[model samples]
Target chain A: MESLLSPVILFFALGALAAFARSDLAVPEPLSKALSLYLMCAIGLKGGVLVADNGFTTELFLAAAGGLALSCLIPFGAFVALRRIGKLDATNAAAVAAHYGSVSVVTFIAGNQILSDAGMAPAGYMIAVLALMETPAIIVGLFLARRNAALTFQPRQDLLRETLLNGSVVLLTGSFAIGLVVGKAGFVPIAPVFETGFTGLLCLFMLDMGLLAARRLLHARRLTLHLVLLAIVFPVINGTIGCALGAVLRLDTGTTTALGILAASASYIAVPAAMRLALPKADAGLYLAMSLAITFPFNITLGIPLYSMLAKLMV
Target chain B: MVISVPHRKIEILVDAPLLRRLRQLASEAGVSGYTLQPTLGGDGDQGRWLDDQVTGGAGSKVVFTTIIDAAGAADLLSVLEPLLDEYGLMVTSSAVEVISARS
Candidate 1:
């Protein structure tokens, strides 16, 4: 309840409301992109400092492996559901599946804040897992879609290269590694910039996101009744799997919750870019509407809280 | 140096995903060369998009423009019509008389 009411979320709500009312309020494109960079750097740095203090542990290795497994496997399940229940064809099914498999960075950030405020912070090394989870699902998705097609899937190399050196991945891992190397001593001087200002920056980013998301929902196209239901249902199922794994791995409740939120969260950013490369024939309106319009808001508003509750149950 | 030649100015504002194919298609269609520019913002039937907005996919926009002889334009346009039809790209080609190749 508190997480839902936090200024961060409320501001997001306000943005969505403004958009719903068709107000002219909007975040300029360049500023929004810069906000994204700001959030990633701050989160990565904080995670790095924590890792520096705690040092590497075996648990981090298991979590990374667990996240990778989820990223790669969830798509297969999503693809099946989209095909059977949603009645989507090969290209659209795989495109939407790829999104369900990949994690959302902002949703994870929101989850991290929710957990930290609740006093059981997740481990720092989870930052690395977040970056690791970005790519494999895309590769899996492309392979699944092209498996029986007459087309050769000639753009795999381009997709692979784009995914590998994607701007988000590069910035995220680079900042994480830098934080790891610099440790606390380096972060201390920069704390005022990255740490103190974090929430304000996040609120603004979420505001922009809310405006975009609600507008996308208003313009939602090509989504059917079954597809909408599948979008909601898939996250709950996938999040549960992740929550169970996190608990079995002996992660604390907060970390488990964070993991669950991640598992449930679908990519709106990275996956869309990758899909555009890998599946040109796929309809952007369908996949983007499903992921951004339906799944993203669901996760931010209800999914995080639900995943947290599930994590608590597991613990 | 200057020369007058009849040509087709091909302009393609396509999703980033199609960039590689666009280039390849242009080459196969025998264009002299093309200038590819990364687009930061655009609007279309799908919706408004910006490079900075983190919708995160290969959905970033790109603009590819090339000038080719009138002879090759027909073949390129033939291929592009179906390609654009399928991919939902915004494309246009217009006949132009080249003022100068080099100056």
Candidate 2:
């Protein structure tokens, strides 16, 4: 319950309330985008520092492989479920599945904070793992989209290029590699800028996210309720599988919870932008609103706590 | 005397997918290219425009332009009319004098 009242949670709630009330309060788009970049840099740097402190190990590589595998596999399961049960056509189903398969960096950031406040420590290489998980699901989604199509075209090449080298993925992975190369001595001079102001910046960015999410939800009736239900339920199922994998991997409670959170979080940034170019037939309001508005809030606010608690039990 | 062809510039407000399809169709129909711009806001069958940032899809708008021969415009309309039955598209054509002949 104490987690619910933390300043971070409170700020998120305030943003949500402002949105629900239809207030004009919003964070500027450019600033929000900048804040997202800043958060990625900070997390990457911190992860690099942790790797330096603890020294690299084979386990790190194993964890990264695990993360990548999850990113690739989840969408297939989600696509099948959404198509078979939810009655979504191939294009929309693939779009939403790609979302669930990718990671939400904001949710990961929030989960790290929640774990730290609970006096638990997580792995640093998880940052590298987060970046690794962004692209493969999109590949899978594209394949699923084209498999059922009657006519095949050369759009796959363009789609692959976009997914692999998209802005967010490039920034995130490039920053992580930079952090690893620079290590502690390199980040020492810049820690004040990246580390000190991160939380405030996150709050501001999330305020913008909240406003965007609310606006999307207001236009939500256009989406079928079946898809909405899938959005709400899919994350919990993914989190369950992640927690089980964490237990098998023997990750510490904190790291396991964070992994679960990462698994549960869905991508609203890079994947959606790529989908716009690749799957033009997919409805944006359906996937974006469901992922950003519905699933995102649920994961950050309640799902984090629940996953953490479950991690504690398993660990 | 320069002969001027009286033509109709058909304007279509279409969804992004259909807009792309229409553009290809227009190009195939022998109409010289067209111009497409980002639509900031609009209202239609989906409902009122809450805000621009809210919706992620380009369900916004695109304007396709071509000063086509009257017979070609009518033919293009025939192909599009059935597709627009289930989707959002508004087609209107007006008479204009074209002297350049290539436009």
Candidate 3:
């Protein structure tokens, strides 16, 4: 209950409400993008400072490997479920599977807030986990999509370049590196904007996210009940397994919960672009609606708390 | 002074990812050149769509227009026809009299 009432969460809720009511409320695109960059930088620096304090250990390596493992494995699970449960053909199933397999950067940022509110600090190296998780799902998704079919369409030469150098990944990893370099002493000068002002900026970004998510949810006709149920269920099943993986791997509770959230998140941004490029015949409406409308909202409002609870129990 | 050579103007509104392939196909079909324009959003069979959002969803809606000689346009259509059956693309072409002056 207390978790649900956190200010950042509430602001997210309010933004969602305004959107549902069809309010004209908005955050400018440039401003929203800038805030996103600021938040990523702030997060990266915080993590870097922590690593500078704690120093490197084998655990960081293990956590990163765990993240890569989940990103690769979850799509196979999704492909099976989509094939058996959703009864989608190879292309559509693969498309949907890819989405479920990748991490949402926005969700990770939101998860950071939830963990902070819960008095847990996620490891900065988790940003690497976040970055590493993006591509494997895409590879797995494309392979599954083309598994049984005669391939005709070839993706653009820039597809891999776009995926690896996506704005979000670049910004997140760039900040992480800077954070490591700057460490604690450097954290002080920028603390005013990146620290004290962080929450306010987060609220603004959440507001924009809420509006986008709600507006997208309004056009949900293409999502069937089976797909919708799978959308909700995938996160829970995958999230639990992920949490357990983190616990077994002996990650701290915060990092464990972060892992669960990353595993559970559905990529709306990166995967969608890749799918459009690679799987032209796949149903864009079906996949996008599920990730943006159903899965994203659930993770924002309820899934975060649930994952945190499981992380607490396991840790 | 201007020359009035006959040509065909081909315009296609397709998801952005398809733009590159379409460009390549147009080039192979011998188009002189092409222009890719971004639309804010529009209504279609699937529903309403917007390019306004910066979310991952934003990149899919685009308009690709190319002009080529009439024979070349027909060849391009032949290439595009099969591709269209598989992707969500709306294509239209019309005969145009080129009104530009060139030596």
Candidate 4:
């Protein structure tokens, strides 16, 4: 309940309310983009600072490997569910599967924020995990789509560029690297912007995200009831699996919860562009409706706390 | 008096991610130049989408405009036809008078 009532979450609710009420509230596109960049940078730097303090640990490698494996493998399960249960055709199913397999940056940020407030702040290496988990599912999804006889596969340089070097991946990884190089002492000057102002900026960003999600949901014609249910269900199942994986690996509770959050979250930004380029025949509306509208709202509002509770149970 | 030359103005409303492909097709069709403009939001066969979407390139679209000779327009349309159905691209070409020097 406390998690649900947090200012960031409340602002998100407010944005959704405004959208549902047909209010004209909007975030400027450039400002929204800027906010996203700021958040990524802040996350990366903080993660780097923590790593600087902790040095190299075996846990980081274990988490990274687990995250990579989950990313590579989860799409297969999602592909099947989307195909058999949701009755999505091959291309759309594959596209949607890729989104499920990838991580949502904002969701991870929100989950991290909630956990930190609860005094379970996850390890910094989870940021690295977040960056690593962005692209592999896209590859799996393309493979799944290609297996269908009707879909034609073409190798394009731009698709490769978009998938691997998308803006979020680049900024997140680059900032992480910058933080590593700078370390804690070097981070002092910029701490005010990235640390002190993070939650407030996140609140503003959440407002925009709420508006985007609800507005997209309102306009979703391709989304079916089955698809919506799957959107919610995917996170719970995958997140639980993630929590189990973390516990089996004997990670701390916060890191375990963070892993669960990553597994459960769906990509809205990076994978969508890749899908547009690679799976052009796929229904963007359907996939976006599922990921941005359904899964995202579910995670921020309810899924985050649920995963945290599940993490406690496992770890 | 300035003389206006007849040309076909090709305008394509396409998803932002497809802008690169559109530009490549335009170049392939021998168009010398084109302009891209962002759209606010609109409802169409696929439903409504807003430009400010945080999902980045998926829901956002751009208007790609180019003025070219009739043959060039025909070539562009021919190249784009294959992708039109798959991408749901909205393409239109109209006869227009352009100031020859500016064009």
Candidate 5:
């Protein structure tokens, strides 16, 4: 409940309210893009700095291994549910599954904020886990889409390039590397912008996200009740698995909650672009509606707090 | 008086991720040059999308325009036909008069 009333979350709610009211409230596109980039860089740098302070530990490796396995395996379960319960075709199901398998950078950032406020900052190396979790689901998704098809499916080299060199992945990992190189001494000079300004920028970005998510929900025509239910359900199930893995691995409370948040979140950025290129026949409307409109809102509003509570119990 | 030459104006509105493929098709079809423009928002069969909302350029749309000879336009259309339905690309070509030097 305290998390719900934070200024950042409240700004998000305000954005959604304005959108629902059909007000002319809007963020400039270029500014929104800049905010997105800034948030990634800030989080990446902070994560790196924290890692520099803590140094690499066994727990980091364990968490990374768990995150990678989760990323690679979650799609299979989601694909099955999407196909059987949602009644989607193979291609569409695969596309949607890929989204659920991946992580949302924003959700992780929000979760990290809430957990930290509650006095459980996640491990710095979790940022590396976040970057690692972005792409494997795309490979799995493509495999599932082509496994039963009659058409000769030749994997394109360009798709591989795009997936690896996605802008978000590059910026995030690159910033992390920079932070690793600069270390804590080098970070102090620029701490004001990346650290001090972090929450304000995140608030602005979340405002845009709230507007986007709400508007997408309003405009969604292809999202059925089954799909919506699955969108919400995927987070709870996947998040529980993540929390369990973290607890089993004996990670601290904060890092465990961060893992749960990552598992629960869906990719609206990286995977969507890759899916568009690789699975063009899949319905973009349906997949985006499920991930961005349904899952994103649910996570920020209720899912994050739920995962945090679960992490406390399990960890 | 300025003299004009007959040409076909080809405009394609497509998701940003597929713009590269569209450009490749246009180049293979022997198009000389083209311009790309960002769209703010629009509604179609896929529902509505706003440029500000899309972070990865996936749901965002772009407008690609080129003026080419009729033969080139036909060639471009043929090359794009296979993907038009698959990618939900909106393509239109119309006869237009351009300055001879520009053509």
Candidate 6:
């Protein structure tokens, strides 16, 4: 119960209410982008710092590898389920599948925040896990789309360029590399800008996210009940599986919970843009609404705690 | 001053892939190039904006083409019309003056 009233949840709830009330409140784009970078760097540097403290082990490597493999595998499974259960066509299924397969950076950030607030610490290498999970789903989604018998349109080179080098992936991985090179020494200079300001900026970003969600919900009538149900159901199921994976891999409680969060969160930004390019025929409203509207809020408000509790039991 | 001809400018809101296809068709229609700008926000039949909060959904796009001659415009329109019919696209064309023509 206390978990529900945590400062993180309160921020999300406040943002949601403000948005629902139709306030013109907003977070500027560049600032939001900068906040995103800060979170990535903060998380990455923290991970490196942890590694510096704990030292390397094979278990860390195994966990990171597991994250990559699951990311690659989930999209195939998601594609099949989306096709069979949701009755989505090939392109739409692939587009939706891409989302499930990719990790959400914001969700990961929130998960870390929640864990930190709870005074729990996860493995540092999990930052690498978050970065690793970004690309494989994209490959799987593209593969599924290209297999259509009537597929007439091919994505342009520029679209392909954008997908692989999208801002989130670039910043996350780039920051991770920077963290490794500089380690504790480099973290100091940027600490005030990236680390100290992270929470306030996150609150601002969540505000924008909340407003966007409310706007999307206004157009929610366009999506069918099946998509809605899938959005709610799949994340829980995926998170459970990820928890079990964390257990088998013997990850710590915090790391396990973080893994569960990673598995549960869906991509709203990078995946959606790629889908718009690779599967233009798929309705953006449907996919975007499902990911942003249903899944994002669920993870932020309730999913994190639920996953954390489950991780405690497993770990 | 260069005399501008009576021509239709077709603006279509399309995803990146279709935008690429349109540019290819424009080149085939003898248009040397067209301007493609990233869109900030708009609404349509599928719905208005996105659900991540209106802001995350802010960057949906539209492509603009300036076709001076009728044949070139027709060729581009012919290829684009059928695609738009099946997909989430807004197509509207208006007659406008070029005012200045470099070509």
**Top candidate (lDDT):** 4
DockQ of each: 0.47, 0.13, 0.40, 0.61, 0.54, 0.31
In candidate 4, which residue pairs clash? Answer: none
Which stretches of candidate 5 lie above 4 Å from their native place?
Answer: A149-155, B100-103
Each prediction's TM-score versus the true structure: 0.90, 0.80, 0.90, 0.97, 0.96, 0.87
iRMS of each prediction in angstroms? 3.2, 5.8, 2.8, 1.9, 2.5, 4.3
- Which of 1 and 3 is ahead in TM-score? 1
Top candidate on TM-score is 4
Q: Is candidate 4 or candidate 5 better by lDDT?
A: 4
Q: Write the per-residue lDDT of candidate 6 for residues A1-315, one digit (tens) a residue.
A: 666676666777776777778777776666766666677767777777667656678878888888887788888888888888889899888888889988888888888887887887677888888888887888888888888525555545746765777777787777776777777877788788777877877777676667666667666656778788888887898888788899899988898888888888888777877776666677788787788788888888888888999999988
Evaluate candidate 1 and give its CAPRI docking class based on DockQ: acceptable
Candidate 5 A-chain TM-score: 0.98
Clashing pairs in 2: none
| CAPRI band for model 3 | acceptable
Task: State candidate 3's DockQ.
Answer: 0.40
Clashing pairs in 3: A269-B56, B16-B60
> Candidate 2: misplaced stretches above 4 Å?
A151-154, B1-103
Question: What ordering of candidates by lDDT runs from best to worst?
Answer: 4, 5, 1, 3, 6, 2
TM-score of chain B of each: 0.81, 0.73, 0.85, 0.92, 0.90, 0.72
Which docking class does model 2 fall in? Answer: incorrect
Query: What TM value does chain B of candidate 4 have?
Result: 0.92
Using DockQ, rank the candidates from best to worst.
4, 5, 1, 3, 6, 2
Better of 2 and 3 by DockQ: 3
Which of the predicted structures, 4 or 6, would earn the higher lDDT when compared with the native?
4
**Model 5 DockQ, alpha carbons vs. true complex:** 0.54
Which residue pairs clash within candidate 6?
A211-B53, A211-B54, A212-B51, A212-B52, A212-B53, A212-B54, A213-B51, A213-B52, A213-B53, A216-B51
Query: lDDT tens digits, residues A192-294, model 4?
Result: 9999999999999999999999999999998889999999999999999999999998899999999999999999999999999889888888888899899
Model 3 chain A lowest lDDT segment of ten: A149-158
- Candidate 6 — which residues are off by over 4 angstroms? A48-56, A146-149, B1-4, B16-40, B50-59, B65-67, B71-89, B100-103
Q: What is the lDDT for B101 in model 2?
A: 44
